[model samples]
Target: MKKIILSLLVLVLAASCQEQQKIAFVDNGQVIEDYQMKIDMEAKFKKQDEAYKRKTDSIGQAYQLDAQQTQLKLSSLSQKKQQEGSQQFSQKWQLIQQQLQYEQQQMEQAFSKEMDSVIKSVNKFVEGYGEKNGYTFILGKNAAGSVMFGKEEKDISEAVTKAINDDYNGKDSKEDATETTEKEEDK
Candidate 1:
């Protein structure tokens, strides 16, 4: 009876000592905002947006100049010529407006798609991170509150962000090295 009770106690203790499933939560917004890749991508997009704006402004200014010139000459022309010129100007202006609208829409769609891809990439990285780290579950807490109340100790946003940035920096360094090697070879 003593031996059986001792053995049972040991078994219970061993079972109690078994590792529990690890769980963590990441603040998705915090992680993405601190991510270096996202910052760089946003800067690139901003530059592109500025360039597009400049191009559109140039086109708009040229159209405006042409329209103003047409308006100035309208009063001096015969009524028929004035009517024809006005009609031509209106058609050209409409065409330019439509083109600008289409270009703006395309630019917006492209930016939206790129942003979506970046977000997806971030989410994928987090998923892989959880898998590699042996986390049984990694919940995301965003504005929508997928994770309502995770303990502060279990929030891995900073660690995950650092890991992601380090990974990004490593890839950038590798790319830079490759580019340098190619240039040296060309020389």
Candidate 2:
């Protein structure tokens, strides 16, 4: 009886001493905001957006100028000629409007697709970081509250951000090195 009690106590103690599963939470919003890749991507998109706006505005101005010229000419023309000029201007205006709308829709769809790809890349990087760091679970704490309240120590957003930034920097360095090599070869 004594020996059996000692054996059970030893088994219980051994089981209790086993390591606990590692879990951490990341502030998704903070990670996204501070991520270097995201920052660069957003800047690129902003520039592209400005260029698109300029192009659209230029096209609109051209249409406006054309309409104004047509109006001015119509006032001095005979009735039959005025009617013919009005119909031609109306058709041209409608076609321009349709083309502008189509271009806007296409730009929106392309932008949306590119943004989605960037978001997915970020998520994949986070997942890979968690796995490589031996985290059993890495919960994302966003505004939606997927993780309600994690202890400060268990929040790994900074570490994850650093890891991602380092990875991005490494890639950039490699590209720079490759470009330098190509230039040297050209020389």
Q: What is the TM-score of each candidate against the true structure?
A: 0.76, 0.75
Which residue pairs collide, candidate 1?
A: none
Please give the lDDT score for candidate 1.
Answer: 0.80
Model 1, span 1-187: residue lDDT tens: 9999999999999999999777888899998889887898889878988998898889889988988888899989999999999999999789978987897888788878877877898899878777766678889999997999987778878777777787787753334434433442343
Off by over 4 Å in 2: 1-15, 78-84, 171-187
Say which candidate scores most in TM-score.
1
Q: Which clashing pairs does model 2 show? A: none
RMSD of candidate 2 to true structure, Å: 9.7
Cα-based RMSD of the predictions, in order? 9.9, 9.7
